[model samples]
Target: RGFFTSNRDGGQGYDDIYKFLETKRLLCEQELYGEITDLETSALLPDAKVSLFDSRFNLVSVTNSDEKGNYSFNVECGKTYNVRAEKIEYTTKEQKVTVDDKRGKTHLPIALEKSTCKVAIGDDLGKCFGIKMIYFDLDKYDIRREAAFDLEKILDVLSQNPTMKLDIRSHTDSRQTFKYNEILSEKRAKSTINWLIKNGVDPSRLTGRGYGETQLVNQCADGVKCSEEEHQLNRRSEFIITGL
Candidate 1:
């Protein structure tokens, strides 16, 4: 017989013990349980996606690690399976297991490595490295101190990847004539490229161009009434990965 404590609708304040008759039981199917962690820090990685694949590399099942970084899966004995764990900003990790009828359960552990680059090649962004849309003071082409600090991130990424090339584009708000803004944006683009060259980056690895106010992010285009913050969104610099 089995027994448990419960508080039913008509029961008293104190919990009462309920009993049940024992019934014939069957053994459960074999299962796999595992944990995922960081390779360097050994910290548990929660919410990581875990996928199970058969010996033929065909996906069998998928699940995510719990908040405690634990995951489980049921399996057929004598079948070989591969498990892959993945999370953003981290390299994916895989492990293989072969289940046996003799074992009722299997334990697997995975350690994922951290990726070097947060933004990959061909990533276009309005902000990065705690800096929002690299912008210059009014009528200025030279790089600002804050912008220089933000550009350092690009330098680091380029230094890490010697073969990578970057394309720089500069834009301006639509406060001035089209030709005026185009010329100012072109100067700003040249200034950015020169700064990179002065910082020891190969000039051959970069190409700078200007689109002026032609590609406004919002309705702050010519004669549009918008706040300074809204206009500021259109006045910015953009970096695009041109080549590997």
Candidate 2:
């Protein structure tokens, strides 16, 4: 009898070859199509580092900026990546880039801003005390653009002194009932607290209290007619340094 290779054995070999060919085809397609562009300004920047990360922020690749402050990297299509740029004396910038199937190349430009001067915790707590309080409109607790700068400064102070504790106090004008004002004030205080927490402030170091119309900074008593500005002064949010 002649020796014969079984059909099963022949079929296994064919399947292995097919898989190998498919993998090679995929590699060739990726090499031909994947592309990316790095955009930067013609400014003298220090050693800037650029990195790409997956959706989970896992570092996929790292590259340094060219002399002209430019960096680039190739990424596969149909993937989402977070691009982060960093330098020593500059604020870190991050952007999200998504490569679409139709668009093979993406241009991502990042501009870095100068970092702000760091303030120490013990620098002068009284510097903020002079600012007095933040007043809100009736039944509203949103921090207006006018107060954003002060809040940013407060955040800076908190960042400088990581161990500092603050009491976020909320007050209201006497025009509203005590019970209603109390609830509104509390909501306002909590809203401000939430903003701070969202901006990276430690929640454990912050506590909130609502004084309603109980603590009046001005002489506008309950029965007295007061101007809008005077009433505003009474309806305020304040932060006090409880612990250092």
Candidate 3:
């Protein structure tokens, strides 16, 4: 006699056990297990989606890697299968395996390379360099000694990428006359660029523009009264990536 389980109607529970004189034992499956990791660091990645597909390209099963980056699936013996692993911000990996007639388990591990942005055209150098703005005294257009620290970051990027080009945008608070502010901002922008040129940056890779009071960040325009902090926000400088 053999023991078996059935979920047929009128069963006392979800699955009821029964004794039978004739039955067939099932042993046509093999266990497949593996881990997912970062290609560069080899660090295990969790919650990565794992998929199994048959020889005909039909999806068989799907599972997610556990917190330990481990996943498993049961595949039929003598059948060829495809396995795929994927996660956000990483490249996907696909592999093929065959479960031989000999009953045994299979092990597979996949690593994915992280995605990166090599270069960005609209990237702001000031923000990238971790500085708010290059400092300049009132009515002055010369590069201050304090600004060197932040300016050096731009120099480094330009030196590393010789073919890269940048554009400088300068603005000032509405405390000064419109025309005067325009001229001062232009000088400030040029002064910022000149420092780069003096430090080995090519002049052809740099361009300067002065927006003056035209691009007031807040409502602190000519006739508007604003707090010192609010007005300070209007005074700024930006270096934008113009080309690769």
Query: Which numbered prediction scores highest in TM-score against the true structure?
Result: 1
Instruction: At residue 23, give the lDDT of candidate 3.
Output: 65
The sequence of per-residue lDDT tens digits that candidate 2 reaches over residues 156-220 is: 55675678888888898888788998988998899889989999998998888898899988888
Q: Positional deviation of 177 in candidate 3, in angstroms?
A: 1.6
- Give lDDT for model 2: 0.68
lDDT of candidate 1 at residue 124, scale 0 to 100? 60
Clashing pairs in 1: none
Mark the 10 consecutive residues where model 1 has the least summed lDDT.
Answer: 124-133
Clashes by residue pair, model 3? none
Name the 10 consecutive residues with the lowest summed lDDT in model 2.
Answer: 27-36
Which stretches in model 1 have alpha-carbon errors above 4 Å?
1-113, 116-121, 125-132
The per-residue C-alpha lDDT of model 3 at residue 180 equals 92
Q: What is the lDDT of residue 14 in candidate 1?
A: 75
Give a tens-digit lDDT track for model 3, residues 1-244.
Answer: 8789999999999999988874675668888889999999999999998988786656789999999999999888788988877776664567888877667888888897784535588888656544457756667777754466457556655765688899999989888788999988898788888898898988999998998878877899878878887886777678888988
